[model samples]
Target: KRTSLSMGEIMTIDVFVERYKDMESILNDVLEGTGANKKSSNKEQELNSRISGLQKIVSDLEKEKEMIKRVDEARLT
Candidate 1:
C-alpha cells in the first residue's frame, strides 16, 4: 500500500504551480503591452474585463483540482 503521496502527485502539483506562474507572467506582459497606449483606455477596460473572466475560470479550476487531490490523498490513507 502507498504510505504517502506519490512522487508523481508531488510533481503534478509542482507542474501546475509552474504553469500557473508562467501563465500569469504572460498575461501581465500582454496587459503591459496594451497599457503602453494610454489613449486606448477603453480598449484596456475591455481587455481587463475579459482577462478577469479568464482568471476567474482558471482559479475555479485550480480550486477544484486541489480539492480532488485532497480527497484522493485521504482515500489513499
Candidate 2:
C-alpha cells in the first residue's frame, strides 16, 4: 500500500504541465503527418472521376465519327 506523503513529497505543478505539453506536440505531429495520405486519396478520386467523364465523351464522339464515315462512304459508292 502506498502511504500519503507530507508536504515535502508533493510533485510540482510544472511536471504535469510538461507532460501535457509533450502530449500536445505528439498530437500535432500525428495530425500533420497522417493527413497527407487522405488528401492524396481525395485528389486521386477527383481525377479518376474526371477521367471517366472524359472517356464517356470520347466514346460518344467515336460513335458519331463512325456514323459519319459510313454515310460518306455510301455517298461515294
Candidate 3:
C-alpha cells in the first residue's frame, strides 16, 4: 500500500512537529514545577510562611476583640 503526501503538506507537517515539540517541552516544564525555577519555589515557600504568619495574627486579633475595642476607645479619647 502506498500513501502519498505533497511536498508542501510534508513541510507544513515538519513545521507543526517542531512547534508542537516546543509546546510539549513547555508543558512538561509546567507539569514538573519543581525543576523550572528554584527561586520561584523558594519564593512560594516564603509567601506560604508569610501567609501562615498573617493568618496567626488575624486569629489572634479575632480572639482579642475586647482588647481591640478598648484600644479603639482609648485612641478616640
For lDDT, the strongest prediction is 1
- Model 3 ranges off by over 4 Å: 1-3, 34-77
Worst 10 residues of 2 by lDDT: 5-14
What is candidate 2's lDDT per residue for 1-77, written digit by digit as tens?
A: 43333333323323444454555455455555655667646655555555455455555545555565576567669
Rank order (by lDDT, best first) = 1, 3, 2
Query: Which scores better on TM-score, 1 or 3?
Result: 1
For 3-75, candidate 1 gives per-residue lDDT tens digits of: 4456577577667766666676776677789899784588777767766766676677567567767877788
In model 3, residue pairs whose N, Cα or C atoms come closer than 3 Å (at least 3 residues apart or on different chains), thus clashing, are none
Reference-based TM-score of each model: 0.57, 0.45, 0.38
Better model by TM-score, 2 or 3? 2
**Candidate 1: C-alpha RMSD after superposition:** 5.0
lDDT of all predictions: 0.70, 0.51, 0.53
Error of 3 at 16 (Å): 1.1
Off by over 4 Å in 2: 1-40
On the 0 to 100 scale, the lDDT of residue 6 in model 3 is 48
lDDT of 3 by residue, 5-77 (tens): 4447545555655555565555455545743566457655655555455455545544454454566567669
